[model samples]
Target: MQTVCNIEQLRTVVNAWRQQGLRVGFVPTMGNLHAGHISLIEEAHKHADKIVASIFVNPMQFGANEDIGNYPRTLSDDQEKLVAANCDLLFTPTPEIIYPKGLENQTFVEVPDVSVGYCGESRPGHFRGVATVVCKLFNLVQPDIACFGLKDYQQIQVIKTMVEDLSMPIDVIAVETKREASGLAMSSRNNYLNDAEKATAVNLSQTMRWLASQLASHNDYDKLLQQARAKIDASGMKTDYIHIAHARTLEPATQNDKSLVILAAAHCGKARLIDNLQVELD
Candidate 1:
């Protein structure tokens, strides 16, 4: 696998691939390789002639008080994982390399109302950072298809909206979230969990399972939302938000719909965990 750390070099390689008439798939990540991220790489590998993955811990996407400084930086390990997955190119750029100079003057992409809910509401300017950086990467890598995990359900929605609004040519593919056997979604933050905390983390996924049962048996949206909120609260985790909405529109469902997503984020000590379940509402 070839690894390029600068945008110019990446673009040069991408141009060469384009000249060869090869299709490229891109997977953007923050550098902690887990089963979930590998799942995206696997999907991309299957779909494209070449797979390009990026591992940049984007500072812009992090909040002032967030764990930007402490977020894991395992480049070598990430490279090994991606290479094992048969990734063609790994674009690992530094912040200065990506932002260059006068980053403040650069145009940004934002989704108005959808950006105001769930994780976006909890972390101000979070999605804006995500949007700006993703747009930049799309320009840099310029892949035919970009793969994103559905672990960040709202994030997938935001990126899809950004791509549509900007008319980017890349197809945005949503890969399913990989979870532990206990049902806890795999996350880099899972490292922060102590033994006891790991058990508590199981509640994050269990809550989603319970809601799926609720939605499956009946079509009471409000009741399901209320019960979910109560369950999360009673689980001793401070709930950020529990949303049962139409997967595409992201609006709260007034009636049972076919595509439904149950997303929740909560705080467990210093670790903020997010998990979601996408299902057919039948």
Candidate 2:
């Protein structure tokens, strides 16, 4: 795979591909590569002629106390994985390269209510950073399609909303969440979990699944959420939020709501893990 750090070089390559009549697919990611990330690239292959994957651990998305400096950077290893996955191009830009004018002066993009609660409440200005960087990437790559994992359910929704609201000419595709054998959603942050914590972390997904199953027979959103939160907290993990909300809007799910999703986040050992399950209420 050809790896280019310069923005102009990336645009030139993409422009050349466009001239050749090749449709491009883009997957934006942080550096720590895993099977889950590779799954997004694999999905990208199905929709577009060429795949362009980017590895930039965005500083803006991280909060003041979050793990910015300690966020893993496995560039060489990630490159090997992308090459094995048959990715055509890898755009590995430095923070300065992305924010030439410095982050303070860079134009920020926000998507209002869609990013308000859930993870948004936990990490203030997180989705603003996400929307801005993704906008920048979308503009730079100018791909026909982009793929994101369903594991980050809120993030995918945020990006979709951003694209539609701004009228960006690109298709956004969400691949299913890849999971460990024990059923925990695969995440780069999973690296922080100790062996025991890794095993315990599976409870998060289990609780989400349990909540999904309950949605069939139960209509009480508050009670269901309380029960789920209680279960996770009893497991010795600090609960961030365990909410049942409208799948698309992230608003609290009402009795009349047909499409609903159960989303949860928790602190397991040193790692903060998030997982979700979507369900259609009858």
Candidate 3:
């Protein structure tokens, strides 16, 4: 894979692909390179002729007390994985490259409502950071399609909302959430878990699945949410939120809503993990 960190080089490579009339696909990530992330790259392959993946650990998306300093950077390992995944291009821009005048001075993009509640509530300014960096990357990459993991269901909603609100030409797609044999949603943060915490973390996904199964026949949203939250908390993990909401809008699911998603987040040992399950009621 061709690696370019310079903005001009990235544009030059992408523009060449455009001139060749080759449809381009993009996957933006914070490089720890796991199966879930690779799945996004593979998803991109299905949509476009060439795939471009970016690895910039966005500081704006991180909270003040979050693990910005300690977030793992395995660029060498990531590059090898990307090449193996058949990624055509990789952009590894530094914070300086992205925010030349500094983050305080850079223009920010915020998508309202969808950016509220859930992770947005738990981590203030988080979605604003997300929208801004993604907007910046969208402008930088200018791909025909961009793929995000379903593990971040709310995040994909935020991005889809942003794209529609801004009328950006890019198509945003969500790849299915990759999971372990035990049903744990695969995440880069999963690395933070110790052996015992790793085992316990699977409970988060399991609880979501259990809630989805129950919601199939019973639409008691509040009761199911409470039960799911209780199950995760009982697993020795602190529950952040276990909410049943509209699959597309991220609003609280209503009785008339047929398409729904169970969104969840929790803390296990040193890692803060998130997962979701989508269900369509009859």
Candidate 4:
């Protein structure tokens, strides 16, 4: 895949693709290539003629104490993975290029409501950084369609809300969360886990799944979520949250809400793990 670090070069290639009557699909990521990221490109292949992937470890999305400096960077390995996934173009811009005016002065995008609570509460200004960088990428690449992994259930909702509120014409596709055989969702942060921590990590997804099964039988949202959180804490991880919410709006789930999502975030070792399970009631 051809990699470009500047907007001029990226737009030049994009315009050339447009002139060729090619439909473009974009996948924006933060390097440390894994199966979850590759699945996005693979999903994009079905929707567009050409695929574009970007790897910029967005500083805005990370919290003040978060691991921005230590976030994994494997450009060469990521490039090989992208090429193997049949990605046509890769945009690997520097933070300077992304926030030319500096983040303090950079024009940012915020999708209200959906951007509140959950990760929004867990990481203040996190979605602002996410929306801003994604908005910038959307403008820079201007693809006909973009793909995001559903592992980030709330994030995909925020992006969808942003696109609709802003009236961006691109189609946003949500791909299923890629997981290991043990049910641990694939994540760049998984690299932080030691052998023992990795073993405990799968319990995050296990707890989520167990919560989902409990939801299937009844609608005792608060009790179920509390039990799930306790279960996670017992697994040797500190629970951040284990909430059952409306799948679409992300408001706390109710008995009347047919569509629901169980989201959990916890701290284990050097990694903070997140996982979710979606349910559609009959």
Candidate 5:
């Protein structure tokens, strides 16, 4: 795969693809490549003639106390994975290039309502950073489709909402959350977990799965969620939020809501993990 660091070079290559009438697919990531990320690129191959993947550990998406400096950056290994996935182009830009005018004056994109609760509540200004960088990437790459993992369920929703609200001409495709045999959602942050914490991490996805099964028989969303929260807390982790909400809006799921999802976030040792399971009521 050809790797370009500057926008002009990236545009020069992508524009040539456009002139040739070839459709392009894009996958934006924060390095630290894993099976889950590769899965997105694989999915992108099915949608467009060419795939473009980007790895820029976005500082805009991280908070002051967040692990931006320590976030993993395995570019050499990541490049190998991308090439194996048959990605045609890889855009790896520095933070300086991404924010040439400095972050203080950089224009940002925000999708209201959908960006308010869940992860947003705990990590303020997080989605603002996400929306902004994604918008910039969308502008730079100008792909026909962008693939995101459903592991970050709210993030996919936020991006979808942003594209629709802004009328950006690109389709946002969400690939299924890749997981281990133990049901732990594969995440770059999983590297932060110690031996004991790694064992406990599976409980996040396990609890989400169990809660999904209960949805078919129970209408008491509040009680069901409280019980799930308690189960996670008893497993030696601090519960951030264990909520059942409308899949699209992220609003609290009501009895009449047919499409719903069970989303949870918890802190175990130094890593904060999140997982979700979608539910369809008959």
Candidate 6:
């Protein structure tokens, strides 16, 4: 796999591929590669003639008290995993290379109100940081298609809006969240879970499933949120939020429908895990 750190070199190589009539695919990630990330890369490889994967631990996406300093970084292992997945190109740029002027006073992209709830409410400015960096990467790679895991369901929605609202030419695709046999959604942060906590972590996904089953019989949205929240709280996880809402608008659902997302976020030991299950109440 060819590793290009600078933008110009990567762009030149991609342009050469395009000139050869190759369709390009892109996967943007923070390092500390896992099976979930590899699944996205594998999807990209299947759909495009050339695959480009980027690993930049975006500093702008973290808040003052967040885990930026403690976030995992295993670039050597990450590179090996990408190469084994048959990735053609890897762009692992330094912070200075990605944010030359730094995040302060930098022009950042925001997705507005949708950025105000769930994970965004718990971590202020998180999605703004996400939107800006994602836009930057999109411009840098300019691939024919990009792949994102639905483990980050809200971010997927925001990016969909950003691409449609801005008319970005790249096609955005969502890959299902890869999970463990216990039903815990795969996440890079799962590394922080201790043995006992890891076992209890399965409740997050389980609670979401329970919510979907209840939605068919119960019409009370507030009660649904309360029940899911109680389950996570009882699991000994530090509850961030548990919500069932319109999958597209993300507004709290007033009645059951065919489109909804049951989302949850919590802290177990030092790791913060998030997961969601989509429901069709038809």
lDDT top scorer: 5
Error of 5 at 47 (Å): 0.8
List the lowest-lDDT window of 10 residues for candidate 2. Answer: 216-225
Query: Which digits, one per residue and each the tens of the lDDT, describe model 4 over residues 2-41?
Result: 9999999999999999999999999999999999999999
Residue 96 displacement (Å), model 2: 0.7
TM-score for each of the candidates? 0.95, 0.99, 0.97, 0.98, 0.98, 0.98
lDDT of 5 by residue, 1-282 (tens): 899999999999999999999999999999999999999999999999999999999999899999998999999999999999999999999999999899999988988999999999999999999999999999999999999999999999999999999999999999999998889999999999988998998888889888998998998888888899998999999999999999999999999999998889999999999999999999
Clashing pairs in 6: none
- lDDT of candidates 1 onward, in order: 0.87, 0.93, 0.92, 0.91, 0.94, 0.89
Q: Write the per-residue lDDT of candidate 3 for residues 38-80, one digit (tens) a residue.
A: 9999899999999999999999989889998989999999999
Clashes of 4: 0
TM-score computed on alpha carbons, candidate 4: 0.98
Q: In candidate 5, which residue ranges exceed 4 Å CA deviation?
A: none
Tell me how candidate 2 scores on lDDT: 0.93
In candidate 1, list every pair of residues with a backbone clash. Answer: none
lDDT of 6 by residue, 1-282 (tens): 999999999999999998999999999999898999999998998889999999988988888988989889998999899889999999989988878887786788989767769998888888998999999899999999999999999899888888888899999999999999999999989988888999999989888888888988888878778878899889888788888878888887666457888878988888889998888877
Q: How well does model 6 score by local distance difference test?
A: 0.89
Worst 10 residues of 4 by lDDT: 211-220
In angstroms, give how far residue 126 of model 1 lies from its true place: 0.9
Among all windows of 10 consecutive residues in model 1, the one with the lowest summed lDDT is 100-109
For model 1, residues 96-146, the per-residue Cα lDDT tens digits are: 887777457666677776777888889998999898899999998899999
Q: State the TM-score for model 2.
A: 0.99
Number of colliding residue pairs in each model: 0, 0, 0, 0, 0, 0
Misplaced by over 4 Å in model 6 are: none
